[model samples]
Target: MTDFLRRKLIQAAGSAAALGPFAIGSVSAQQKGDIVIAASQPITGIFAFAGTAMNNGLNDFVLWKNANGGVAGRKLRYVSEDSGFKLDQGVAIFKKLMASEKPSFFYGDSTQWAKAVAQDAVAAGTIMTSSTSLASSMADPTGMPQHFVPGPIYGSMHEILMEYIAKTWSKSDKPKIAYVYADTEFGRDGIPAGKARAEKLGLPIVTEIVTKQAGIDVAPEVAKLRRARPDIVIFQGYILAPMPEFVRQMREAGLQSQVMGTAWGLDKPAYDALGAMGESLAGVSPYRYGHETDSTMINAMRDFGAKNRPDMKNISPFYISSWLSGMVFAEVADRCIKANKPLTLPNMKAALESMKEWDSGGIFGTLVDLSKHQAPVGRIYRYEPKTKTMEPASSWLKV
Candidate 1:
């Protein structure tokens, strides 16, 4: 193996050791210094909007850590690559990230690609945290400890959102519902899961529609949904794909539904693209920028935005969530260093496993219950286009 892949395998294996009592072997001086991290994201293709924000968030956290005196005298050095939201590209990047770049951990670009890379990352013994807040085959209980999803899974969020709709319009005559999604594994995962939950709640699912990534040729789908005169419509797709186009076309076609989206669908760029029509669109999201009370972290984000991305006005919830993920990783790294554990994957994973009810000072309050190797806690937020912001929709949702 190349030097970089060797380091990645060691880091992943170390994380497994942390889960148990296994001991990790030491590395030479070259791979023995600072904790190196990498992120692979969609910067040029369908997932670009969210991917760009996630990358910026990762970079910002590393800068913040370095400015704050570094994590235990070892500054975090992070890198990111654009994968274009292609599965082949994603697989290739993982091979490179593992075999050449040698990062201690990786943050996934999207849910679809997360599934593709998690297996390889696990086999290589490296830890990967995903912003793809969807439950999938990768979330199977038998999976290894290579993955961490610190947000409300798509299946769970869909159930709750459907329940909320049922309760909110309970007094009215039976309300019809419609579902629109992309034509991908990530999209297909939501259909069965949402249908099962909606049926369990006795909510009538009137129309089910799917569209491709190229553009919104969803007129036929909308016509079918309009025939049902649905009261609720849920979209499962990406910010840069057919979602905004769907909203615009559906609205222009004079078919109005109480439109909401899955976790990945809502963000500032999506809202901006849809213009005034975006007002009716809402969805479940993982983080909120203005809701933060951690003056330290919030101020840092504000300063960074002002200095670097002044034109990018609204820092969406996912952006903050991505930043928080890196912060949590840094905290784990700090713990491992304080304990004199080597800053490899195994030691860092061990430190994370040791944490319980970690108060990430302000922006994060979820308990890191690693006993089951799952992020057992999350929160839900709703967006308001009038304000162009996401507000807390519920208290922390826990498993």
Candidate 2:
């Protein structure tokens, strides 16, 4: 770790120690061979399908880790609550877990909840990860220092996509682009940075369309996009519903612009909803798909699913991402123990930041980097209807 990061960890540890009983009490009384990990997940509402799969994947990883002797011989005790995809509910669940469970680590549901409980996590000296990969704000070491993810943030994904677009542009004229995102923090988190990057690439953002997560009428949005006539439309902040509706509506309105999505916007659930329309879609993703059998981790996930959830047919990208999140926490915790450091909040943070080119067992295409607290690498993939898969359009690019 650099001097700057070391100082930040020391300060965080000092703050926690100074907070007296509350901070001290935040550490759960683990029995021999026990480490508690808690999460607030979106098991209902708009993100229900994706959230439930994420929960299952996380739970399965914990089970698999325990079966495999866990991290440094300490069995993980994973606990999670349903957030219902509501910010207030997520915060409430987080507080409940912090107060009652006193877990050493927490996995939050969204960018909003991560931001909401950041101070609490820091004050209590708890390490926290999130379900969302690319919330750029959470990657600020000085701001939400305890926040970390297993994949790149939204901004990095957008930057990679923009670079790809710049290279792929065949015309001498600058490519016209438009951003169509949900009107939520998750949807709009990366737009400003993305817009700045686009400007730098000489791609004019012709239109910006913000609609509700559950947009009932997308004709107007499609009409605006049609008028702009962008060469490409990048989507953010949506998992399945409005995005598919918008794409279908765009097609209906005779808009032939190539559609792309952020990580959240490009997943099995989204493709299932998009059907044939998904063929024209492409996006940046931090984790390999569940169908990528070549991955050892993915193969393990498949075996676990076959034995545990035989009724379930497919493991989505969201599930893989969630599983990777759990694995990352376990990896960091194990490293702390191997270094003879107690699995305290400060120690966990240090272990995470100390990681440099650490292999993720193929959870990600590139080695993990926790200094930025973001994955910072991914591949752009285009959906292939014939194979019914998102085939890689480019190699893993670190941003």
TM-score of each: 0.79, 0.89
Model 1 misses residue 330 by how many Å? 1.7
Best by TM-score: 2
lDDT of each: 0.65, 0.78
Per-residue error for 244 in candidate 1, Å, reads: 4.8
**Model 1 stretches astray by more than 4 angstroms:** 1-32, 84-101, 111-120, 126-135, 171-174, 240-255, 273-275, 290-296, 308-311, 343-350, 353-356, 360-386, 392-399
The model with the greatest lDDT is 2
After the best TM-score superposition of candidate 1, give how far the Cα of residue 347 lies from its true spot, in angstroms. Answer: 5.0
Q: Check candidate 1 and list the clashing pairs.
A: 12-125, 12-126, 14-346, 15-346, 287-317
Assess the local accuracy of residue 203 in candidate 2 as a C-alpha lDDT between 0 and 100: 82
Q: Write the per-residue lDDT of candidate 1 for residues 32-122, one digit (tens) a residue.
A: 5667678777778855766777788888888878888887787788877788877788778877866666666677776666666655665
